[model samples]
Target: MTDTPTSRATLDQVGASVTGFFQDLGCELLEYSPDRAVVALTLAPRHLNNAGNLHGGVTATLMDVAMGLCGTWTEQPEQRRVAITLSMNVNFSAPAAADSRVRAVARCRSGGHKTFMASCDLLDESDRLIAFGEGVFQRGALRSELP
Candidate 1:
């Protein structure tokens, strides 16, 4: 069977529960699906380091959020899947200035019933590569069944 496209409303709710840290970090879910996930954030004074550029930790967090959610993509809000990062790696290729709009796109590369691997690319509005990450995640309970 062909893959069905997930709705925008369903996609927006993708990380509502498990993304507290990312949401608190000012990241917003732009798009989410089994094939790809997009997340974005705007840099603020608090997001910078002593040198006044984007902090590396923030970059990594964005990548992690994107990668983690991509594998858990589900069209059903009640049946949403959840996964935890088993291993992750991030590489920074450039620095983002204050107020830059950063976006991350992640896609699942391979997977099984128990685990999946994904990759993410963090970029600025101009599409400059800021950083990228890859991770292996273990599947967990569904959101509705998480109690």
Candidate 2:
């Protein structure tokens, strides 16, 4: 389904329940579906490298977060699962300056009972492809199974 402002609000609410490094990265969920996810962030001084461009790690983080969500989403939001990154391959094609509005759109390429593969394209406000990536993720437990 297409993302509307209402859905975006719902996405934000769900995102708020998540806390940690993602919040540190200042990423926001713009849209999501069982097979796809779109996230946005504005480049900040903290996200830039000493050379004055967005850090590769920041781009990778965006890809990781976007692609992970692409694999984790379920038709029933309450039934959604989580995943850990097994591997990720990213290609940086361009640089985005600090303060630029960026977006990462991820699409699930394959999903299995235990694993999934996804790809994401990162774009700048100008719509230039800044980075793109593919990732492999393994499903994680809903709750601790350890004693």
Candidate 3:
């Protein structure tokens, strides 16, 4: 990442890019800001697990995306962040049915020169908490290069 006036522009560009990327995945942004972000996705049959409930991987992915994006919203253009999922502890509280509108809310807890930490929760349409996660990510290089 290169910090410059142009970097600020790139940051804005990333916001749009992130939105587009999720939209393509059938997720919609309901709220977004530097400290928090919320996204929703309608559970489909394709997202089901072997037992018929929403898959654990799907829930984890949604939480991760939301948390990472929350960090992105606060980052300077020249300073990119990569979500490493260094540690994610997820608690599944309920089973989510197909066609349910699932919402993921992510909040950044702390961030600094080289790392960021965040938490996220996944809720069903009725606002029932289905799962929650806390994650740590290393920031600076692009995600592809982060280890």
Q: Which is the leading candidate under TM-score?
A: 1
CA lDDT, every model vs. true structure = 0.83, 0.83, 0.73
Q: What is the number of residue pairs that collide in model 2?
A: 0
lDDT of 3 at 67: 86
lDDT of 3 by residue, 18-114 (tens): 5433545577666656767787889888888989898888888788878887776534433445455577778899999888999999998998866
lDDT of 3: 0.73
lDDT of model 2 at residue 65? 86
lDDT of 2 at 116: 95
For residues 34-104, could you state the per-residue lDDT of candidate 1 as single tens digits?
A: 65889899999888999999999888888988888888876567787788889999999999999999999
Using TM-score as the yardstick, the better of models 1 and 2 is 1
Model 1, runs deviating above 4 Å: 1-6, 145-147
Worst 10 residues of 3 by lDDT: 1-10
Q: Over the stretch 7-114, how does candidate 2's per-residue lDDT look in tens digits?
A: 755587556644577788888988787778888999999999998899999999888988988877654454446778999999999989988999999999998988
TM-score ranking, best first: 1, 2, 3
